[model samples]
Every structure is written in C-alpha cells, then in structure tokens.
Target: MTCGLFQILMISFFHLIELSSQQETRFVYETFRGQENLYLDGSATVLPSGLLQLTNALHHQMAHVFYKESIGLSSSRQLSFSTHFVCALVPQPGVEGGHGMAFVVSPSMDFSHAESTRYLGIFNVSKNGSPSSHVLAVELDTIWNPDFEDIDHNHVGIDVNSPLSVGIASASYYSDIKGKNESINLLSGNPLQVWVDYEGNMLNVSMAPCEVQKPSRPLLSQHINLSDIFPNRRLFVGFSAATGTAISYHYILSWSFSTSRGSLQRLDISRLPEVPHPRSEHKNLSPLFIVLLGFLAIMGFCTLTGMYFFRRSKYAEVTEAWEEEFGAHRFSYKSLYKATKGLTRMDFLEEEVLEKSTEEISFQTEK
Candidate 1:
C-alpha cells in the first residue's frame, strides 16, 4: 500500500545518490606533463633552469601557452588540475608591475586578441568582463586591479567566463602550528603550487608554497556550471600571463590534470625538481650536541640497571630475614602437648583433687 510506495521511493533516492557519487569519482581524462608537452607563445620559453617560462621581465608583454588538445568539461563531471609554478617580480626603477598569471580554460588556443596586464593575457579589455568570453580562470594575482575592485593586491581568485572573480581569498598558506592562514609573498621567487577543481557545479582553488603541504581549505570556491558558458564541452587548457610597465618571470615546473569520470590521483611531484631552499641557511646538530646525547643515553641505561638490581637485592634480603626469624622458633608437637597438659581426663581430675587437698591442709594449719 502506501508503505510499499514509500519504500520504493526511498530505494530510488538512494540509487540516485549512489550514481551521483560514482559520477563524481570518475575521471574522463587524466595525464601529466613536463616541459616537453607545454606549447609556449609570445615571450614564453623553456628555460635551461628546467621551468616552462610563461613570461619574462619585459614591459607590455603577453604570453599564453596551452596543451595541444581540447579537454572536455561537462556539467555532470568533475575536472581538476594542479600546477607547480613560480612567479618573481623584477623590480625596476620607478616602474610599476601590471599583473600576475592565470591557469585558464578557453574556447580556443588563440591569444591574438588576449591583452596583457589586468586581463592576465587571457581576455582583452573590451571582453574583460563580458559574459561571451567563454573563459574560466584561476588567477594568482600579484597587483591589484582597481577597475575590477579586487579585494587585495595579492590574492587567489576563481573566475568564470570573466575577469571578475566570483570568489577570492588572499594568497596565504595554512599554518598547522598556528591553525590559521599565514601570508606569504607570492613574488618572492619561491616555487609555489596550486590546485583547481570543479565538481558538482562548484569551482575550488587552493594554493601554497611547494615546501608546504597543500591546505585542506580551498582559498577560493564558488558555484558555477561550465555547461552554461561552454555548450560544446570542449576547451583548451593552459596558462597565461602579462607584464605592463612592470615585469616578472612566470614559470610552470610541472602540471597534472584529471577529469571526474576517472580515478582520483595526486599530482606527480617526481617529474619536477624539488623546491629550492637556501643551503647556507640550513642547520644540523653539532658534534657537541651528538656527544651530549650519547652521554645522556648511557647514563639513563646505567641508572635503570642500577635501580633494578638495587630493588632485587632489597627484596632478597627481606625474604631471607623473614625466613631466618620464623625458622628459628619452630618447635615439635611434643613440646606443644606438654604446655597444654596431656589429652587424658582421669589424670587431669586426680591432679586437680590433689591440689584441693593441699590447699585445705594449709588453711587448717594457718587456723
């Protein structure tokens, strides 16, 4: 009856949920790339330093590079990618830096109309905020874009088909010890990593230094559907950057991409060089410290052994003393029987009568 119908409905609902979860876990495309697969344009080059340089410190320059194929992005699917990159602003005398770089997905690989500066070389000024641009970007912005009403000069932002970020978070890392966000200079020439994920109509962006672990909390996350903007579901994936009067070097050391219809996997860090650290600033334990540690270890062992033997010897001495004192007083059963008088009723009565007669005679004599 009604209960049966309700049960059927519940079963259908659970099945739908299970299907959704399965779709979310699937990846349609998954691959990794190094410098060889990255196609560079404009000022971008494969540096001898093993980084795919997107832009040099030249003024009013724009560079856009993308992979050779068109990636599919569907409404029901999750798409994710990560980039290991570094951007360093080259300070010049009395010159201002324009903008930073972006991980972008666009309709085509052509950047002929893409402008530099605040546009990040992905969109021109005319189409910067237009809905028809058909572009999705995660920006690592260095300079503030006043016209766009940016939250801060340095931040991570999620952009959908426009330069305006639907959501933004100041570029920072999660400090596990502090349990809070710790700001870092993005233009400090340090290698950084960023993850971009689009799942169930939400776009999430997370960033941190290469030396630091990836923060669980995404810097910027927003709800958006790519199907609305990208009807064809095919798009070009790559990076873009621009320099205004100010300049910087933009590089991508490695990149990994995956789609929701495939297995979830982490970015392959082995293909890239380890993040650079200063050797001179590094410190290790001194020889004196090692010697002290060894001495303390030996002393601790000796103390433990001494305490163990001391307690054992003390216990043995107590046991021996107890046995010696108790063993010496043990007497035979015959001596105990004499102390209590023999178990004979007639002898006990005769002894008692004799004592009474003696007592009576003594009393008469006294009288």
Candidate 2:
C-alpha cells in the first residue's frame, strides 16, 4: 500500500513539471527602409552623401497589432522589440557634415513628421498645441546641439512631439579632438549599433560597436508609464533618416523581437535583396559535453530516487514485521494492564524501571 501511494505521488509531480515546459506563442513583424540592401554578409555600405528614409507606413502599424482589443497585451503579457543598423560615413572632402539616425515609437501612424534638418528622424510638432497627441523617438545623435552641448561627439537624446525639445540628454566625449561635435567621422567609416528594451513601466537603451558583443547597460532609463504613450497598448516602431538635401545612405542588417513568454523571432531588415552576414564567432560548449552532462544528471536523479525507495521499503518492511508478530488485533487494554501487573500508575512506573535495567545488562554483556 505504501509503495503504491509513493508511486502515485511521484507520477503526479512529474506530470506537473512537464506541463510547465510548454512553449509560449509569440508574433513578430520586420521591415527595412533605405536606398541600399541590408545584408548579413557585413557588406552593406553607409551612404557617404544622400539621406535614405524608410517608414513602415502601410505594411505593419503597431496600433493595429498590439492592444487589449487587438493582440491582448495585458498586464500578464510582455513584449520586446529590437533593430540593428550599420552607420558608416565615408570621407567627403570639405563636406564633413553628416546626418544622424533615430528609432521612434509613437501613437500616431498616419502623419509624417516635418523635416527638422538633423532632427528630421524625430517628431516635428505642428504649430497647434498637441504635445500630448503622440510621443516619439530615442535618438543616438552624433552632432552637437548648443543648447545641450555640454559634451563632445557621440551623444544620446530623447525627443518628444517636436524638434524644439530634441536635444542631447547624454553625451560621450569624442575620441579625437577633430571628431568633436560631428555625428559621423567623414574619414573612417566606424559602425555603431543601438538596442532598446521596453518592459512594463521601464524603458532601456544600449549601444554596441558591433552586433556580436553584449550591449552595454542602458545609457538612459525613463520612468514614464508606457501605458500613457501606448494607451491602447500598441505602438508603431520604425526608423527614419534624412539629409536636408545632403545625400547619404542608411542600412539595417537585421531586426527581431521576443515576448515575455516567447522565444526570439527574426525580423526582415531590408527592402532590397542582400546576402546575410556570417554568424558571430563566440565560445559555446560542444553538443557532446551537453549530452554527457544530461546523462550524468539523469544518473544522479535515479540514484537519489533509488535511495528514497530503498529507505521507504525498509520502513515498510519493519512496520509489516511488527504487525505480523504483534498481530494488530492481539493488543488490548486488558493485555496492557496484565503486562504492567496491575491497572495502577505505580505498576506502570515499576515496568519502565525493569526495562531500563534489562537494557543496561544487555549493554554490559556486549562490551
């Protein structure tokens, strides 16, 4: 009876463990906007001149997708989105100036923001008072703004509603004195990649020199509740670039997203056809080592299970032997009273004293 009960409990526990391993459902959409094709082969070139801008406009809008009435992104669910771009500025003689780039998420998807020169990628508010109409942009700006030019070349900014509010919030000193305040170095084409994460009420942004390396801790964090900007719980995400007639090219190699409960899904990063880059080289353990570890783990689990069963079996055996020898029906109130010589408290005390004396005698004999 004990063995049967133990087996049933073990089976029930294992079934619950299996149920927790089910995969979660996740959905993803990706679009690339630019003049050149973004590819995986690491061959896409950044425009030396003309500006390129790509907007999701008609393909996939955020408001149409993630909402309580749409995809049902409630408090219990979470969503993650990220994109990768390669920005390189080739030497352009006396024309050293280059435009910066931005990643934007806003409530409105219909209207195109006005061009604000270097700030064109960010929202440009109309003359009317509608700052609360929509919120847009976290910019990785390279150029310096006099209003917030406390630092040097590479800087980060957050823009909302209009270009008037578009200025640097965080800036990194330029590596070279000549490169100070310039968004891109015209001589050497150095590439930069940025990553953004928004979960619950928090927003985080990070940047990496290459796609293979781990992203640095968020450069900036804001406490604004995402529910405010995305009241409907959906946001349109895309990139925008412009050059004020100063030509240049922009390219996005890849983009992807994952939900709080789901696995990562690949994103389409190019409107033009291009070859994919080779996978990044990183140290990972061999599959054989993983299999060996799994085998050892299984063996350890079995050993522990066997020990438990053996101990349980021993306890059951002892109990069964006691029941057989004593006979469950044999022990009665009269038998107990006779064993103690009388139904008196003094008789019971004397019986305990005799048991102690017998144990001492047995111990002395063994020694």
Span of ten consecutive residues with least summed lDDT in model 1: 24-33
List lDDT for all candidates, in order: 0.70, 0.46
Candidate 2, which segments miss by more than 4 Å at Cα?
1-93, 125-130, 147-153, 163-188, 245-247, 265-367
lDDT tens digits, residues 1-367, model 1? 9999999999999878655543332221122234355567898776555556677657888888787766665445544543333334333323454488998888788888888878888887778777778888888888887677788887888887677888887888777767888897777666677777776777777777766777878777788877777776677778898888767767676666655414435555545643332232345679999999999999999999999998666434223577576776544444544676654446679889999999999999999
Question: For candidate 2, what's the RMSD?
Answer: 32.1
lDDT value, candidate 1, whole model: 0.70
lDDT of 2 at 244: 44
- Candidate with top lDDT is 1
- Candidate 2 residue-wise lDDT, 1-367, digit = tens: 9999999999999766544432233433233334232221111233233222232112111111111112223443444444434433332233333344566666544434444445544444343225465555766544555643424434666655544333444433232334332233321334454556666656666554442343344556665455555666555555554444343333344454444423555333333233222232555779999999999999999999999998666434223577777777544444565676656557668889999999999999999
After superposition on all CA atoms, what RMSD does each candidate show versus the true structure? Answer: 23.6, 32.1
Residue 260 in model 1: lDDT: 44
